[model samples]
Target: MKSRKFYISVFILFLSVFSVFGQTRKQLEEQRKKLNYEIKQVNSLLFKEKKKVNNALEDLNDLNRKISIRAKLIATINSEARILSKEIRVNETELKELRKKLADLKEDYADMIFKSYKSKSQQSRMMFLLSSQNFHQAYKRLEYMKQYTDFRKKQGEEIVHHSNEVQAVNDSLLVQKALKDKLIVSEKDQKKEIEVDKKHQEKLLATIKKKESSYKRELQSKVKAEKRVTAQIDRKIREEIERANRIAREKLKNAPTKPKSVKKNEFILSPEAKALATKFELNKGKLPWPVSEGIVVRKFGKQPHPSFPGITVNGTGLHIVTKQGQDAQAIFNGSVLNVLVSADGRKNVLIQHGNYISSYNNLEKTYVKKGDTVVTGQKIGQIFTDKVSKKTKLIFVLFKNTTRLNPSSWILRR
Candidate 1:
């Protein structure tokens, strides 16, 4: 019984190990899969315009992201392997203990059986009990015989139980070993991939170094392009504000149930628009991203360049760089305010949510027009992908009436 208790304790301890680390392994596997998919999307961003050099910066960024994810995957694999090894060890030890316990139980049961066989006749046992010195002694003798019979039966049952436990432990050990072997293979594959990626990254770095001046010029042009889109967004937002203000003033001039004063930086809203705006505000930091699959190559607000030194980049929105031909989705239920085109002919869709507005700029084509109501996650437009630079970047901006809001604060963290 003492040995059984010890085995139960060991079994419970091993169970907790699996319960904790098994969940960890599953989560890591999911993360690894998601990162791999994102890397694939990033790779597809490279446009197939023949005779044009790929954007070294964009390629490098993607390679870096891939390398980072692969390294994490390798680490996760090693962690899973370690846990499996520990599990195997624990189960193997338990199997040994169970085998020993089963042997002891079986031996005891066999001894009990032999004694029972030696006392062959029921009449002999009865006569032995009847020859006791007193009534008390006879009763004690009968109790002892009953206890022996029950104990022998229990021993036999224990032997069977321990044998089954041993079999289960053996099976578990095999499974753990197989899992460890698979994880090791996966780790090796991840390492090989990282090595190949690093080599390519080095080659790209060398190429950029040889043409540093030209690359720097290209970087400047890219920065300028981003700034151009940003300026267009701000300008369009101001124009919308003026339009809304004009409508509000006309309403105030004609309506008898007018408010005393118009609130600053807030558009005049109908009751439905006010409710939608409240809902949008309530969903702050939880809004869906404009694109389904992309990376935030440039973040909202002022920040330093990823590769360029001493260069400051500023934007009011999150810049998601995605693959070619990706459609922009509306983040919330709202009416299309306007579909404006930039100087370079890239279109942008502005959707108004009560006092708030969201702008998806740098679209190749618009799918909705002004005054058209759209639902959340509805397709609004296709994003513009630059043919010359092989760049497909989206500028996503948010606004509270005329005030610019950082889009990073609103979009979901993918």
Candidate 2:
């Protein structure tokens, strides 16, 4: 009984290890799928053949993004390969042990069968029982014979079970080895693609360097525009917060209850608004994308300019590039705080989820107006496609009242 319990414990431990391995393998597969999809989106949206004009900066940036994702995909494949290698090794060891165990069981069973054959005659077994000195001795001899027969039968069954286990482990080892080989091949292909993209990136960089002055001027103008848009967004959000607070204060003055102290820059929330805010917070890292399908071309925070050394580009939000004519969607349930129009006629729609806000920018038309309630995945407006660059990009930003948050950290990875 103790031996059986020991075997069961070992089997459970083995299963748990494989369970963790399977989960990790599944996660890596998901990451690979997402990376592949993003790469396809980048190629289809940014590298269209109809984009006749040569924009060196944009081209370089797009190539860089592609190379980066390919590298990540390769890394993911490598990780999966490592896992497969480990599994294969473990399976091989188990197969060896199982085969040895099966061999031992067969040998022992053969020995038992040989002894049983030697005492095959029923008359010989009866004579041995009759040779006992007393009735009790004869009874003991009979019971011993019965137990020997049962033991032999059990030995045969164990041999069969061990043989089957050996076969199963051998088959598992073959599958793991094949998967490892496939991953190795995939990693090689990704490396080759990265090499080609790097060459193209070099050419784009050289072209930019040749016309350095013009490139610098273009970069400065773009940077100035980014700052202007950021300022507009900040002002609008601040104004919204102030407006909400003012309304809350007005209601308090007319009511019998004492007014609660409020912060100057933050929102004062009612019970319902507070609940909505809590829900939004709980759903962090699970929010949907502003567009159904898009690639983040520019991320939030500060990074050195890809074209020029020393100069840095500060981004206040994520710039996601998608197919032309794609409509922007609300990531969560919210009310439209305001529709902001920039000097270039591009519109930005801001939606408020209690104190949390999501902003979608670079739209040519607006579908929902201020004070309109929007549900998750609701289409708010159409994304503006640049005629010159031929890029359709949406700038998405998130905030907690007056605090800026990284959109990447909040949105779903895919």
Off by over 4 Å in 2: 1-30, 121-124
Clashing pairs in 1: none
TM-score of each model, in listed order = 0.79, 0.86
lDDT score at residue 263, model 2, on the 0-100 scale: 71
Expressed as tens digits, the lDDT of each residue in 291-336 for candidate 2 is 9888888889998876566678987889898999999999999899
lDDT (C-alpha) at residue 94 in model 1: 85
lDDT of 1 at 171: 85
- Summed over model 2, clashes come to 0
**TM-score top scorer:** 2
Report the lDDT tens digits of candidate 1 across residue range 1-414.
122332353345434434334456567567657756765665565323342556776676666656665655565566667767777888888888888888888887888788788785545778889889999999999999899779877887888888888888898888778878888887788788878987887777677677777877887887798777667677777777778878877877877787555565567776677899899999999999888887876677787654555667787687788777889999999999899887778898999999898988889998899999999999999998777676778888888887888887887877
Query: Any runs in candidate 1 off by more than 4 Å, and if so which?
Result: 1-23, 43-52, 120-153, 252-264, 321-323, 388-393, 402-413
All predictions: root-mean-square deviation over Cα? Answer: 10.4, 10.6
Deviation from native of the Cα of residue 27 in model 2, angstroms: 4.5
